[model samples]
Target: MYSVVFQEICSRYGKTYSWDLKSLVMGKKALEAAQIVIDVLQLPMSKEELVEESQRKLQELFPTAELMPENSPEQEWGDFWAERTGCAVPENEGLELLPEAALGTRDVFKPAAFTLPDDAGRVYSSLPAPLSRSPPHAVQCLVFEDAPNGVEAALTAGMQVVMVPDENLSRDLTTKATVVLSSLQDLQPELFGLPAYE
Candidate 1:
């Protein structure tokens, strides 16, 4: 029934959610599509509610769900713009993060995220200032690819590292270079301040 659900979503609100489901457009496009779906479908609900309701109904029909959404911060980025340095946040509030390999750009390893928020808002992906050098630091980038390992190393090296797991996933984390590794075992124990795991 996955096909059925996809078809329904496309046929019913495809034009509306096109920005959200499509792999191309970013920022305001997604926000608009989401808002359109909410309105046309009369889904008068908060961002969280909309996501939850869609998940519930979709699940009722298809036992095997396929949506792999990224992490979303509860922070209210209300009325934000995406023009300046840190304007990559609100526009990307509820965007989805997909797997790479065949879906992402070769310029980056992590999956790419799309959005529909305005072109002049903060999307959380672009942090402001010196901390923005996340991708340059060796251990920082490592922690990004392998968080637990990176975190442990940062701890052992006496280097302070604060991770903002919120707003993480495709665009933001890729920009931050802080995507969390899926399995702890995938990271070396040396990454955890101890000998490599055997």
Candidate 2:
């Protein structure tokens, strides 16, 4: 979806994006990605305009595009956690889902608040009640984030954050992370006290 819209925009400007550049912007927030594209192309468009145009294009394309995977991998990633970590996941606020579906045999939490500094509890509390048996201390947590805002959120909560940034993101924007990596594939979970991948 984004690639198609971005390619269309780039075509208008006689610009082309490499896959690496596309990967970089893929991790950014919508407007942030749009701004990066605008800067890269030196497009005479505001970030808001770029976002609006992209969204309009997405709306037009999504219904017709062969979007859904015919067969999603049978929960390989989620199941791995389910086996080793008891599978408690967080449900962000404002998304619609039933309580049972939201927090069931599979643990899921929705933070009480999204504010910074004091948000550590919210992050912890988002874990299903049972899995939150450990005391709530930010350092005990490790956050993996892609966007600067998410990094800020984890930092404000006093957790160590591992940033997997878009390759094209500014180096300066990633300095605050405890560590930065090109991809989650490079993550060493044991360094953060999690069980190492098998």
| Most accurate candidate by lDDT | 2
lDDT of 2 by residue, 171-196 (tens): 87789899998866567788978888
Model 1: per-residue Cα lDDT over 1-198, one tens digit each: 322443455455433433223222222233443454556546445545544554455547543434333332211111111121122122123333322322333322222222111365432332111123333442232222222223333444333443433232244333323224344334443544534433
Q: Which candidate is the best by TM-score?
A: 2
RMSD (Å) per prediction? 16.1, 8.0
Model 2 misplaced stretches (Cα beyond 4 Å): 1-4, 15-48, 60-77, 83-139, 166-175, 182-186
* lDDT for model 1: 0.34
Cα error, candidate 2, residue 112 (Å)? 9.4
Structural RMSD, model 2? 8.0
Give per-residue lDDT, candidate 1, residue 39: 61
The Cα error of candidate 1 at residue 78, in Å, is: 37
